[model samples]
Target: MTSNKTDLPYFSVVGIGAGPANLSLAALLQARTDQRIALFDKAADSSWHSSLLHPGVRMQTSWMKDLVSLVDPTHKLSFLNYLVTEGRLFAMINSQFDVIPRREYMRYLAWASGQIENIHYSTPIEEVSFVEGEGFYAISGGAPVARSQHLVIGVGTRPTVPAGLSSLPDDRAFIADHLALHLPTMSSDKTAPVAVIGGGQTGIEAVLRLLGAGFSNIKWLGRRQWFQTIDDSPAANEIYRPAHQQYLQDLTRGTRRRLVEDANPTGDALTPGVLRTLYQANYDRMLEFGEYPVAMLPGRDVTEGVLDGKDVVLHCSTAERLEQHRVAYAVIAVGRQSAPVPFSAELRERLDAGEDGDLVIEEDYSVRWKGMDDHRIYALNRARFSHGIPDANLTLLPVRAAMVINSMLGSELFQIRDELCPVQWG
Candidate 1:
């Protein structure tokens, strides 16, 4: 029934990662509550997708979906305020772009990170364990550095590589996260064959970047019938509204999962701008070389790849036939998987788990774990099925943060009002 302060530095809450999800949570709680919350990240500094901040890459989501706007529009940390305070408001308007640049978003996140009071960088949390009466302890560097009454895990996702390509040496093959870093070495041989795997936005971006870098021979592979652009139409956009998110809760888990899958074009596809940019560039190049530089290979899933001397051989299967392609370099952009939770054995065994060992996320984003008396662990961006597609996107970030804060404080500190439904579903 007692705890000592000398054992570990304590707080009301501790966030595992300082990415967008937890950053939004920290910003809201910092502005509204006196409760002490700290974040620990293994990153050496504050950065979001730093290496992949490609020169031409832009955000798919609007800037209005910033961290605090949906719940607290007037908060000093709004994206509008960031633009104004940083002296870029008019400059941004002059550009007349549909979406902000990814680099700008990363800068906004870094700026927000600096404003938040307690974010411990370069501090890796290896284990998060809960003792019966003492609350949660975040162990770092082989010792418990911090303790908290509650925990929020928002470490984000990691790039994935298939088993066939995983064994390739670092120089020959890697995920797209390292593309920028490898561009110089890659550009040395502009005519060398390059293979990019996966069908999503990342793969398309990789192909586009290689084309921009004067790479002559590039093979772009996709599992789908064709490359797809985001359906950001008004009706499709309505799926990301908070009203739609709540409506999803009433449906069965199986049905909710199906809807999220069907809404893939909204988030998982390429931006129309990027697709058009590639097309125009390809057209211009064809005028000079009499052929397109990048070969678009769709309706084919790359089943395996192997290192053949300095080259990588990719085995792919299409509806009609099987094929093999060789390339000097390979970039695997096959999507991402959620980052692992640093839960200790004692804590992990007690939590309600799904078939995949993930925490069973409740409607409020908190995980149903044992011994959650006054303390809780909230998982952000981990419940795509239950919360709809917006659960894993920037659209409802502030709303989710507000819900978590409201549930944590047991009162309506921040009111979330999504009014006027365009579509009513049973």
Candidate 2:
């Protein structure tokens, strides 16, 4: 339905997705009350890292790196505040690490979202277009409605399933995203071997979870020699330090992009301690009950897989460079790919063409297009290639949110840009 101008906001900032990145922006706007903002997500409610939420999975970043602390350290809704409210602050301080459980972190995010007003859950922005002279138009749940001023596209990334594996029967195979929720319902009598693809955190976590759940005969296959560890050392995390902000802000765009790609830090992966615990658990189970449910086949690339009779056979080439071995059920955890925005063909064409596209931003988190002089269409996840490493990830979300807000307010709240770090990876 066409919303009346009186009913609609005159200077509204539309947030496309309600994930942590955009949620941080929403929280900032709510805190400042500078502009009329409405945040939307396709999901029914707020969720963070639901796919990898095994019982013991915890955040890789400390609670201090939450939605607002990096931008405004004194923010009340910070993770520290959440821990205090939960009565875990004192105990958490005594622990070696400051991370909270994934479930608890998710709950804290949901709580933060609830406290913010004007956030519309389950409302997905279908398309956004700039109206000549009349600000912008956002087509959400209904007819195209004009929203004056700005728009923020924070839709996030889509799960990256392998190219050949999409045709597999849904009942037989699953992605890491759906495994946790659906694994319990899977048939218990089947002795079929399960193969998990990808060497990333999700793949490792999936293997561990399956073994923990009493599943037998699970194979974890990865194309890489070994899973790469994140640079969590105090010195490395200096990328997020305030001192590095000037360096990042002054670097060239191309250099910034290279730095992000080379870093390739995957969060929430099992630490050395956690990996040891998982190995000990598997070993204990094997020794006590004569059951070894898990096996690691690193440096193996999946060439092909097909449903053979009652079981799925995964053809994999290992480091030994031998022929492929067939296995049943493949869980591809290769991670997500960047998804294109659902804009009209005209807008897409305009974006592809450099003339209008340059006006379309690759820097700062805001989405803007050509011809919309008075309005800016800022993106939360779209400018990763341009804005550098911190755009999509939670690593610099608090700072990114502040930057977007500052851009909207015509202020310089966050001037930190991407800097070219020494090439640590080849």
Candidate 3:
């Protein structure tokens, strides 16, 4: 077929969302192959998790698990190289922190992004469609802007508010992503009652931020029996390796999903020292005042939230009873859901979906779609059920990218070798 849009820019690969996953893939593709690759993101800049990047808050993963090190340690855009080239190597080491600050990580990402080529920020690819024999076309603002032989969707996740709480007044109740933006206009009275929902790290960080902002009356709610810390032990860390990921790939879908859910405690819980920090801050506030400034309520599952006059009333249930709490404002950090892909209706219908209604992703991360020949679409961070816990995080970022690149090129361009495994997988 003759190309009609010959004047427009064309790439071998067009990746949506230049987040860490896509950034890793783009970096590797640029270094290893002569492939003309381009990445498009809706965000104006590479400020990852910017809203929840509170001061003193640290990353859950180690600095070693950066974008490129796992598969290509010698890559020019490795985190170590970033520190050296940016003149922060000695200072970063001297800090001697358990984990580096997330703000620093964001800076490292932005720095690395600047060095990469053909990354178009502030450009949203609204629709992606596949023409019969012409490959993929990325449409923005109702017109095709770029053509690509391959597509990679890595748009990442967005903070989700529960359906029950979705109707809450937007100004008074909101997701954690907007907490920082809404803090100033919150309340003139520091003691105004507020609630931070969800038991994960984001929820704790919200509580800490409220305390720091001089909020005297704050309630921290969690569905679990208690606020849980991540299992950062040696054994737990081993699950993040490539070997375990491969082991997970061999399991049946149902079995793999169950195992991955079981592994959530290893990475999904609160970061170490975060809960302690919250507790110590509450204690100090208690010492100053007659009572603790923050109230920790665990095992309370918030089922509904409604605006009662100026306050947001949260209806929660416990193991034995139901209760209600009122607060001037609520910051919801329940969890995040995957961002929607911009696939056109025709293309969406042609893709093979799983029992879960998501695209059927193969072991190598490519989506099983109709009419796939030399052109293919790869999905990143969307195969948790088959790829295990590491699929949803920065742990095996480069390794996943390598898998996609190897599968795309039909050769072993990058080798992933995870040796010295102590635990055997069945």
- Top model by TM-score, which number? 3
How many angstroms is residue 114 displaced in model 3 relative to the true structure, after the best TM-score fit?
A: 0.7
lDDT of predicted model 1:
0.88
Q: Tens digit of lDDT per residue, candidate 1, span 211-245?
A: 88899898999998999889999889889888888
Is 1 or 3 the stronger prediction by TM-score? 3
lDDT of 3 at 45: 89
Worst 10 residues of 3 by lDDT: 1-10
lDDT of 3 by residue, 90-143 (tens): 999999988898988999999989988999988899999888767899888778
lDDT of each: 0.88, 0.70, 0.91
Provide the TM-score for each candidate, comma-separated: 0.97, 0.87, 0.98
Q: TM-score of the candidate numbered 1?
A: 0.97
**Descending-lDDT candidate ranking:** 3, 1, 2
Model 2 scores worst on lDDT over the 10 consecutive residues at: 351-360
**Count of backbone clashes, every candidate in sequence:** 0, 10, 0
